[model samples]
Each structure stands twice: as C-alpha cells, then as structure tokens.
Target: MNRYERTRVLVGGDPGVAQAIAAEIEEICEVEVLDAPREELVMVKVRESARNSLFYLGEALMCSCRVRIADAMGFGYVLGSKRNAAYNLALIDAAFSSGEEFERMPKWEERIEKEAKRQRDKRAKNRALIERTRVDFSTMDGDA
Candidate 1:
C-alpha cells in the first residue's frame, strides 16, 4: 500500500500561525491551509490509515493551535471566537474512539435502501400519471 496520501488542512485566524503549523505538518504529512477566519474553528483533512496515531497527532495539532492563539492574542480575545475549533476537536476524538458506534456502513446501506424505494415509488407514480393522461384522440377524430 502507498505510505503517503494527499491531504489538506485549513487553519483559521492569524496567517502567520496557520502558516507555521501548516509548514510543520507538511514536513511529515501533506497539508494545505486556508487562513480565513470567516467561520468558526479550523478544519484539517488527512488520510493516514485513520488510525489512532494519526488521530492523536491531529488532536495534538489542534491543541497546539489553541495554545498558540491564546498566547499571541490573549485568552479572552480568542476564547469565544467564530472558529469551530471545539467542534473539530470533538469530531476528531469521536472519530478516533467511537469504534463500532461510529461505523457508517449501516447508515450508508440504510440511506441507499431508502433512496431506492423512493425512486421505485416515484417511477410507479409517474407511470400511473402517464397512463391516466394518455389520449384517445384517434377514436375521437373517427367519431367526429
């Protein structure tokens, strides 16, 4: 299997800090950062086996970003900023530890089944509608 996979990391807030973190991660893993703070929290995307080690490293990186922001711009300034840092952290934690609870195969299968049923129902309804709308214009012309 390939050892490395392409990934992108979006870091919000200060450009310098975001760039620094991006550079650090780029050394060992592929990374890209978009230094826009319009939304709350930063988003990092990576494909490293989806294993514990990679998860922990991601978590650690988030923590580092938090600390770096806090140190540079005071605690209260960034305490409740627009970023979804907290959510990202929690998501990483869940993804790492949720085990069978977070497995998405069942959900995906259910979604597919529901969509298929919907399509079948729609087709049946359309067929009925078309049949009802069919014209007996030929017979009408002969009688007229």
Candidate 2:
C-alpha cells in the first residue's frame, strides 16, 4: 500500500499493530528521535459545494512526531493528543522508509492489509444498515 493508505490504516486500526512493529524495529536497528511527539493545531480545509470554493472549516488538535531509522527519515501525525500512538507511527514510517529493514518484519504488510479490509467491510455493513432505515418521503408526498 501507499504511504497515505498505510498511515490511515495504522491510525484507524489496532494501535497494538503499530506498537509491536515499532518495538521490533527498535530492537533490530538504531532509531533516532529527530522530533519528539508534540501537539499542534492544523487548519481543516473543506470545499463549499454550493459555491465550488474552498474555506477553512476550523482548526483541529493534532499530534505529530518525526524520527530517523538508519538513514531514512520518517514523520507521523494524528488527530488528538495521542503521544504514544504518534511516536509509534513515526517509528513504523521510518521502518518503511529504510526499505530493506521493513522487509525483515514478516507479515506486517499482510496485517495492515487485513485491517484495511476489515475497515471496508465494517463501513459497508454500516451503510447497508443505514440504507434500510432511510425513509422514502417522495413516495408519500401528495401531488400538488
């Protein structure tokens, strides 16, 4: 998976997956904390559908961190003040950046892919449930 997809899965899925992978990498390689986990505000931008224009929705609290594994640099950011999660995310990113070291972590990618699929299945199920509850107001309306 690409970085965006990988990050999304890591952030939304099981936190233990990221922690375990990071711990394994730390034991096998040298990890330098370039930037420790810290909280910050990032502007949320959205498009105004009616006007077809963009605007800032508001600022959202976020946690971010940076680290270096071997020679590759990695960064991670997540909504809210999840310091440990952000740190672990950065470590995982660094592992992926190094390429060769990431290969040594057996089944990590498979685990991530599986989590992504689970999320998709969950969303589909929720959508189906919501669809069943949808009311057909148009059909009940009288001709005027």
Candidate 3:
C-alpha cells in the first residue's frame, strides 16, 4: 500500500467563499485551503480516504458559483508516479497560500548557490591535478 496520500478540491470564488467551503471540509477532515483570486480558484487538500467526500463538497461549492476541479491525484509514492501531480499541487498551494508580502527564503537560495560553487571548484581542482599528472611519453628515454 502507498504511504503518502493527498486529496485536492478545487472551488471557484474569492477567499471568503473558499474559506467557507474549506471550513466545512475541515470539520470532517484535515485540510489546507489556498485561494488564488487571480485564477478565480480555491484549492483544498485532504487525506486520501477523504477524497470522495471532498469531491462531493467541491460540487456543492461549484453549484453556488462558477468553479472547476483542476486536478486530482490520489495515494502513491509522492516522489515517484505522483511527482508531477505533487509538484503542481504544491506550486498552486504555495502561490495561493503565501501572504501578499511573503518573500522567498534568501538563506535557502544562498545555501544552494554556495553548494553549487563548491562542486564547481572541486571539479576544476580535479581536472587541474589530472592535467598536471599527464606524462609526455616522447620526452622520456627508453632506458635510463
């Protein structure tokens, strides 16, 4: 059985509308709701078992307004078969959930840049050492 699980609910409207639907779902299952006003959509995620219920709730939300269920990918290895699904969901979630003033973590970016620089430096050093050790066979005498 797959360990990791996720359920996505897509609703249409503003934050207030999304929050209401999310609150209702939260009463029955653990969920995180993200509102994207620019896209006119709200995303909700829950556990695998709660997917059906979330879908039903999504339908109800749609009836009240215009909304579309973007996508749904159930339980599986998050990094394997479901990588793309997981990634897309995360991107949407992050974009919507992050506050208006939210900024990317500069420290994390700096760390990655530093690591890449170190790797490049190590590779250059290795290449230099190999070149320095390369022997010119023509310059050596057959016998001492």
Ranking by lDDT: 2, 3, 1
RMSD of each: 19.1, 2.0, 19.0
TM per candidate comes to 0.26, 0.88, 0.28
**Error at 19, model 3, angstroms:** 32
**lDDT against the true structure, each candidate:** 0.33, 0.89, 0.34
Error of 1 at 58 (Å): 44
Model 2 bad stretches (over 4 Å) = 101-103, 137-144
What are the clashing pairs of model 3?
none
Q: Looking at model 3, which ten-residue stretch has the lowest summed lDDT? A: 59-68
> Which tens-of-lDDT digit does each residue in 100-134 have in candidate 3?
22233333234334544655688799999999999
| Candidate 1 pairs with clashing backbones | 40-82, 40-83, 40-84, 41-83, 41-84, 41-85
* Cα deviation of 55, candidate 3, in Å: 44
Q: Residue-wise lDDT of candidate 1 within 30-117, one digit each (tens)?
A: 2222232232333444557756343322321223222122112211112244244432322222222333333443443343345446
Best by TM-score: 2
Summarize candidate 2's per-residue lDDT along 1-144 as a digit string, tens digits.
Answer: 988899999999889888887788888879899999999999999999999999999999999999998788889898999998999999888888787745556688888888899989999999999999999987995976
User: lDDT: which candidate is best?
Assistant: 2
Error of 3 at 100 (Å): 9.2
Name the runs in model 3 displaced over 4 angstroms: 1-102, 138-144
TM-score of 3: 0.28
